[model samples]
Target: MTPTPVDIPTLLEISPQGGIEGRSRRYEKFLGDMDGVYRDEHAWQDAVGERGTDDLVYWVDDHRYQEGPGALIVGTSTLLPGRYGEEFAVTRGHLHAVADRAELYYCLSGRGVMLLETLDGQTSAIELTPGQAVDVPGHWIHRSVNVGDEPFVTLFCYAADAGQDYGVIAEAGGMKNLVIADGDGWALAPNPDHTGYRAD
Candidate 1:
């Protein structure tokens, strides 16, 4: 059966950038009750390329957190249910040139590696597992790839102010340059920095 949409409250709690700050406070009020959102089967699989990867079966859309003339562009977690050792694509994550919004990811179950590429041609990898959360700050181009031994699931919380100058998402698809950067320079893109931001 097709997956149904999720509620606002549930979306907020499970998302990486969601939930009330302070782990201790979150436990006192939530007790890790992310409702029905599980980490192992909730993080959506990103679709890369023309044919696209039909991995993420569930999505929450650009609502829930999208507020303001409103730049609060938010979407809930997605689900990818493939066994580990198999490579998978998450989403073709994007951000506008001026939008300083932050992307948050919260892991509910399973463990996986994330591949992140910045707009300036930097790359890195991150190890993720259950009950862990990671933040993808603003002004950087990024994407999430599932490199794990088991199915990976997690929640995503997109936060942005609608009025920002660059609040749009730009996909790298069809961009021959591969990597875009300041003024007059281009280079063949390398693996993205998933663990941290670019040094330059």
Candidate 2:
């Protein structure tokens, strides 16, 4: 006989400033943890030397009601604004371990871009401001780039079982495209260091 699901429906209070009122867990990424995440190594080193290792770069507040495959995981991502050479502040991107799992990122505040690419060489960059959102399809690796001067905050949701594969970008020498600062906006430039994404 099948067992009844134990999780009860609950409310999640998400703040436009970045966090869940009753988050189950919170994780932070520091400047030191972004060793090779940026394309400009020397610039990254300079920033690290100036800010030190403990400088907080980004953080996530997530609420997971259950671990089942059918469960949903909701979270808020807050990426502090910064510049490393020409590239803007970004999150260490990932493709869902399940590969076919999709996600939604809704901009709550500030300005940003959702950089997405497929293993087959397709790429897209969608800029978002307050009240904007992006529906990320499966098979695409995605990352967030903050283009504004304030904290870029977003409310994200995806399958609870869609574990992240953070190594995909590193393995590919970074995503095929880089979101760089334009005169007063942002632009997508080809990542010269990227070789290509390997098939899973």
User: Which one is best on TM-score?
Assistant: 2
Error of 2 at 155 (Å): 0.3
lDDT of 1 by residue, 1-200 (tens): 65334313332334342332211121111212212111222332221222234323333333432234434444434434332112243433445344466677667655554445555654555656787778867655554444443445566556445223211222232111223221322123332322233232
- What is the lDDT, from 0 to 100, of the residue 184 in candidate 1? 29
Write down the lDDT of every candidate, Cα atoms only.
0.40, 0.94
Residue-by-residue lDDT tens digits, candidate 2, 147-182: 999999999999999999999999999999998888
- Global Cα lDDT for candidate 2: 0.94
**Candidate 1, which ten residues in sequence have the lowest lDDT sum?**
22-31
TM-score result, candidate 2: 0.96
> With candidate 2 superimposed using the best TM-score fit, by how many Å does residue 59's alpha carbon deviate from the native?
0.4
lDDT of 1 at 85: 15
Query: Worst lDDT window (10 residues) for model 2?
Result: 1-10
Best by lDDT: 2
User: How many clashing pairs in candidate 2?
Assistant: 0
